[model samples]
Target: MPAPAHRLGLGLAAIARPAYITSGRAGELGDDRDVATLRDRSRALLDAAYAAGVRYLDVARSYGRAEEFLAGWLADRPGVTGGEDPVEIGSKWGYRYVGGWRTDADTHEVKDHSLDAFTEQYALSRELLGDHLGTYHVHSATLDTGVLDDGRVHRAMAHLRDRGIRVGISTSGPAQADAVRRALDVRVDGEPLFTSFQSTWNPLEPSVGPALAEAADAGARVIVKEVFANGRLAPGGEDGTEGARAAAALAARTGVPLDRIAVAAALANPWAWRVLLGPVGTDQLASNLAGAELTLPADAAEELTALAEPAEHYWATRSARPWS
Candidate 1:
């Protein structure tokens, strides 16, 4: 098995925008969320992640200048952006950032999975990241969005695949299993259109495990996101829920932080190719990286497994979280 550090990736979601749905943002980022401040913070995080041996970087169009921040950081690093061992970069489309850099924006992003949306976002992503962009995913692709069933979108993504860029889908909500299974059936010119999959999988909500396993079996790269459940499992995070309480107890007994335990749980899944960590600061990044060193015992892992909540309840709690 590859070292956990090698399998860990940094997600630029929390730092790319002024506000996100993740908990503990107020304490982590405070009120200094201006564009330049966040840009600098993003660069600092990229520096720390690269220095710590984290190579895979996740970004998206709806992540409010995340792609732009990554582009700038890559430009500063000559050999890091290209060459044989360049960092693996994955980005997503299908949603437009509408927050206008405002933390109080009524609508932060608007989703449109149409061919037109793909065309526009693909052009923008290419314009910003250029060839550094490795895999492109459909942001929050659900069955109801018809993204998996859209033949035109598949053909467009197939064109990118021909150009050597891998295409995939990132799933969300309670129906992640349904979406992942459906995406597995998507084909273009008799070939699999998507070779990568990203989905939320933490100790608290692991309902998509079976589908992700099937995706990995199909030779798809399975990436786990929201491993900390949007900061609810992180230190100083919300611990009111039953799942969170159980995780806290386990963490207490094991003398490990909840964030590290969360990361270990996600990494324990053999099917996970890259487990993403969303950290707003270097301290959090360091703590999360240490999780890669942990060897979670089987019994302890099972104890955490008992923390699983119904997919509906998990997502409902997530949706109700205030965007700070």
Candidate 2:
């Protein structure tokens, strides 16, 4: 029998390029010499995530051939439904991989949300992912980028929707909440264009949750990213801030790992359809899956919820993250 697909609320992310990049031992993921190794590693991660009951996998064009890696892994799986694979794939455009897999590249990626960029990256993503591709989003849509206000882009998105492809936006920056609210308001000829959204929501930067809840209430599928605040809530994380301390206290009280408690907090949100797990290895993935099973006590949850930092401070700290 085929593996049953998980509900929309849980998924995996390939941002770490696990197999292709050597991580931990070196400050960087492995170099080009590690392509085969990285592929194997990513494949193992996918296998584990599926076994752990994750059905949605998020990747982006800027994630260094993540689309290709996902395609290779999905080739062997049968669809949960009759023809479509049980796994739902969500990939984004608007960012290009400029790193060439080199650790020393001055810039690893460059973001462009122009109509031409969408045209090119969409074709590239489609070519690489084929039928396995499910939803496509405009990566990191900001108020300044004006992606939401562009009629041409809306037309393109609406056309994709008409063809049965789900369209949405992934937002970044301090104004992420505002961006989400605007995205929810976008429409082409009376029908809403976006049915999905990927946004950041963690203890330190949860300013977007209410907006996400609004999106969810409006019938959009909401995927939460950065639940661990880019590892800030992990054990002995670099931030050393109050949010991290709260996570540690919760872990001690519950006897769960700090990471697990952090992720569990995000899962507790009813509006989050899927809280993405950015595990870099089998052990991390296992830890995250365990977190998914935890139900935090209401008081503990309230303590964690109160850890939210001002949106500006949170995004500033995020902006300074060393591009891992």
Candidate 3:
């Protein structure tokens, strides 16, 4: 009689340190405090995240102060602090630092995922994410000829795995996630890399539907990020009523809100092994966790599917790039 692995994972996504309440940057996470200063705040957040049952911690090298801050706090802690509350943590590399200053505050940062960059970056991830680093990604790059040709990247990854690290890719698009899955299916030599794939999948795009199913069928673990349509599904602001209904109805049974409705919907995908979430503050975390505690009835699930349809327009245009 054991709890399921998915049940144990917290559906937590460690976004680029919440730099601006946006995906764009990691500087907004918080000003780099002089070690001792930010230390307490970082500890509090991670502590709360742990206590709340968050098992997955997602991060990236390009995420400004995020990885550095995490390395600051987590480097010394052992995995499985409490025996019963087990966890799996993941991080991504492949972006270069080159003196390390804040990138554009508004423009989204980039993911390199090249072998030369990824090799060094993975070293940094090892220092920062500790035992929580379950999966490593070739972060954010679309498929490239370089991915296959980089013997150094492959060798570096093999080195890490020989040291007991699990390696994978952080695909930028639904199509890319599929490509990673395909690669994993045929990987029979050396390290036997990447048992997981982390990608964006939710009600809005639903583009990940087939890829997720395929990944699951391939037995590659699927970790879904952005379950809330990047915050559109939440119940604040002048919008989200229709979105709220499905959640509210589901909440009739679970007592949470649209947040849980979204989580339930993502979980309903069966192909989804875990739903990773990002929260701005403590109150938001409580609400999301509360939602996590409930299950949606069949009717509620269908209603939720219809509710999410409108979410398609929430971010109609990535406007500049990778959006739209």
Candidates' TM-scores?
Answer: 0.98, 0.90, 0.75
Candidate 2, residue 305: Cα displacement in angstroms equals 1.5
Q: Compared with the true structure, what per-residue lDDT tens digits does model 1 show for residues 129-204?
A: 9989999999999999888998989999999999999999999999999999999998888999989999999988
C-alpha lDDT (0 to 100) for residue 52 of candidate 2 = 66
Q: Order the candidates by lDDT, highest first — what do you get?
A: 1, 2, 3
- Candidate 2 lDDT, 155-248, residue by residue in tens: 9879889988899999888999899989888999899998898998988788898999999999999998877777777654536677677777
Better of 1 and 2 by TM-score: 1
**How high is the CA lDDT of each candidate model?**
0.92, 0.76, 0.57
When 1 and 3 are scored with lDDT, the better candidate is 1
| Model 3 C-alpha lDDT per residue in residues 1-324, reported as the tens digit of each score | 123223323322333332333332232244453335444555565666777666666666765556666655455565544466555667777664332342334444554656667757766777666666767776653456466345566677766676666776666543555566555643425535666677766655566567668777867778777676655555441133455445545555755577766676677777777777666445666666665656777776666666544323433422222310
**Which number leads on TM-score?**
1
Residue 192 local lDDT, model 2 = 94
Positional deviation of residue 44's Cα in model 1 after best superposition, in angstroms: 0.6
> In model 2, which range of ten residues has the least summed lDDT?
19-28
Q: Which stretches of candidate 1 lie over 4 Å from their true place?
A: none
Candidates ranked, most accurate by TM-score first: 1, 2, 3
